[model samples]
Target: MDIIDNLNAVKRGKLSRRAFNRSLLAAGVGLFSAPLLPRKALAAEGDHPTFFTWGGFDIGELYQPYEAANGALPNFSIFGGTEEALTKMRGGFVVDAAHPCNVGLKRWVDSGLFQPVDTSRLANWGDVMPELVAMQGNDNGAGSPWMVPFDWGGTSITYRTDIFELEGEESWDMLWDERYAGRLGSLASGGDAWWCGAIKAGVDFKDIATDMAFEKIAAELRAQRPLIRVYTDDTTTLEQALASGEMAAAMTWNSSAVLLQSEEVPVKFAKPKEGQLTWVCGIMIHKDAPNLEKTYEMIDAMLSVETGKFMINDYGYGHSNLKAFDEFDEDTLKSLGLSKNPAAILDEGHFMIPQSQDWESRMNETFELVKAGF
Candidate 1:
């Protein structure tokens, strides 16, 4: 899928806006987020195998050695949104499990779309980070773990410190500050922008269903559109924008900022006072997946500390494996925005999208309206 990776962001779909919202509504609607961990989940007896996840993740050279060590590559598919992934599963999309963020676990589990992961199968289970296990209850605790976390990262403000003087405690509010109107930047897509907006408005993203709250956030975004010069889903393009001085402030992934700064782009990723938006993406087995053992191998490959290091140092996402950060030198963790106390950062409200189709539709529509200056 060729996603927009430039300043002018555009989402391509065959369906019309009305149809898109209708499809989402029919699919159980709302954003994904971690809530009170469910005490129980359904179990499966090795039916489907293989995994699916976010684009450009858990693939490439990092896992090559793992494949050589484990044998065979796991079948994979990509999803635009967690809800979309869950929709397909509930609608009978096959596979044993799926990779979703911490925020979406509860809803996915509640949807009865997956079985608890038998952690005993994941040898790295004991070595995994507690912070990750906290949000995603293990297979043992929940009677079935909905998801196993792999990579984690913060949605932080990426700015060209050379050109922009970031004074005081930084936060998402700065992305909307009129002071930087035309110079300000953001991802035009619904997910990142919505999370940023939710945090700025002090609205908990996990529980965004009320119309009034939606409208308030709509107003906040509408107020921000004119100030936005470029809204691209491409993190690389966003980083280049800052690097080339085409734009000043940008909302970017932690890895992008770390990579940029390492190369001397004069960028700094600070967790804003209102808190930064965070996410964790992992492989999930579709309930009736065809490739079972291969899928488990893929998960095992990803859970390895060596793989975790590549994800953190090379990819820049905070690894859910607590041990991954330890693999890094002191300078590396700081450069990557890994706070000393990693658990505290995980405790920060992990942004989850609204699962309610009505609310989610409105959120997307709100973005559309704002982009259209509606």
Candidate 2:
């Protein structure tokens, strides 16, 4: 297959990102020439709203309706993690909208960097799941929400079924097993890892902000630190390691396991007996969105069923629009670790509770110190 075909395959989960890169190198493609791969023409910079989001969410599949109406996709900016994105925005970087999960909702709102979204402006607003829209700190008390919910999913262990020997039922302890020490990986972001640490530490989310909870979670993470072969925010690194058998397992989002399985890799997204760390992520309009009208169009397009179907089928994430689940049967949703009734999966998992900016800062700082071998 040609480069364009390989790129499409990677997007569709048919080809691994590592294999796609290998093919590019074997074909004598250079870093500069990589951009020459066939893609829809985009309007000149600044002609459309800029979407600041996680790396993978910037693709065309999620913006079909907006592209159809505007004849080009929005200008895109990618962040490795939400914390990094928030830090940049707080440093005076401006964008039309940004993607952040429910756990950070209160902190984001308290930052005073975003504005309430007028649901009436979005065409798909009514179909958006009420559960997601009603997340803590989402309501502005004016019938508008500070953030419009988009994707929701769990963070858990993605392990090699063929290589990793199971001694018991799946649990968070798999990540801490001494047998797999130095053969495991983890996401570097505390937003995910620290919460999973809370789970493994048996600290309730409601008391996560307490001093005792902080010490317990930090101790758990410090214990896992020596076992981890690598700590990175890049899912590609973890996926590549698992695919090559360099690592037995890694903490990853649903997409990692789904992508590996599509390539026939013997991997499974573990349903820990302790429950997975669940979260809801969505977009918030910047307080100074230069393209307010187009921003609404971007949010509406993301809430469309087409985007939702692609998210579920390709990435194994739950879409906020309830109608998005209509295209998938119960069996398919079950296999993907999802459900038509989101509450079925969401309520069962250890959902993250929003904490204040002070707690978030302190937790992240402590986690960083632990990861640094302090």
Candidate 3:
């Protein structure tokens, strides 16, 4: 099928997103795996700017102001992971803006594919978290910001509360528990799973890619292989598996729990004793983007309080805007496993740090081997 046909298939639910992504992966196109919202509004053919992002962010709500001004939501193409998106962009796929996490900020910026963002243009700049604004590589060598920190969340165990019995505070060990073997699931990307294994193996995050750390983390993951029934970047699949008792427990992000619970599935998002694996993903403008003004409008809209509220409450991810926290009471935040203060939560979690390209290549290759029973 053609590109438009494929997109139409996914939009209509006639195709499983994972299957479509796998086909794209086979064709050297990237897959988008993040939470996908059902289409809220579809614009006329080519009426909207294109946003290359994780699957679910194509919703019109986050870009309301942009749509209000331009008369349509941006067209979206999705990728399953940051690395996949980066690879596609490097291979010449262009969009107005792309979403990438801090772990990838430096590499994406250094590739010279993105232009720096002028903070002055973002009306919500003052309300953005300072730490995220100052994240490494967020600054161009010339001092302008290269990325706009947008959404934040943690990677941890999301288990069926009705199925799994806890012995103590929730832990990553629950994933490796023999009792749940064949019923456990995990994300496929080493970007997440390897770090999660590091936490379970007791490796310091700072030493995560070191030889000693790699050995320990590898051993832990090797042991975990047989326990996992599936390894995929498809959050929707994982959520369904958990709800249907196909997965008693799984390594998933906070959104999975929120989405599942919203559907009335009895689930719990755990604050693992070792700590949750945390990340902040944001938007970067393409250096050659055609719709520069509209892109800025879209970026600013995403940073607004309206978008922030949807991100935090509906999606269970933290918003970059501090004012977004005011929309939720402390009790509600706690119930969703979030802190009103993003910094405290970030400091407590095993936040992903920037790594060398060499390290990333090694980890990806090694993890694939480990998954293949090496």
Q: Give candidates' CA RMSD values in order.
A: 11.6, 3.9, 6.7
Question: How well does candidate 3 score on lDDT at residue 253?
Answer: 91
lDDT of 3 at 46: 61
Kindly give the number of clashing pairs for every candidate. Answer: 34, 0, 7
How well does candidate 2 match the true structure in TM-score terms? 0.90
Whole-model lDDT, model 1: 0.65
Tens digit per residue, CA lDDT, model 2, 1-374: 47878788866778765577556444544211111223454433765899898866767889999989988889888887787899999999999999999998888998999999988899899999898888888899888899999999999999999999988899999999999999999999898999999999999988998889989999999889899999997787887788778889999998788777755668999999999999999999999999999999999999999999989987889999999999999989987889889778988899888988888889888988999999
- For model 3, residues 1-374, the per-residue Cα lDDT tens digits are 47668777877888765566545544644334453445555442363567888767888878877778877787787787888888998999888889999887778876889988888888888899998888766767787888899998899999999899998888988999999999999999998999899899998878887999989989999999999999998786787678677789999999888766655668999988889999999999999887887778889889999999988877889999999999989989987778788789888888788887888999999899999989
Candidate with top lDDT is: 2
Whichever of 1 and 3 has more TM-score, that candidate is 3
Ranking by TM-score: 2, 3, 1
What is the per-residue lDDT of model 1 for residues 108-134, given as tens digits with 9 covering 90 to 100?
A: 656755655667788778877765665
TM-score of 3: 0.87
Q: After superposition, how far is residue 189 of candidate 2 from its true place, in Å?
A: 1.0
What's the lDDT for residue 221 in model 1? 82
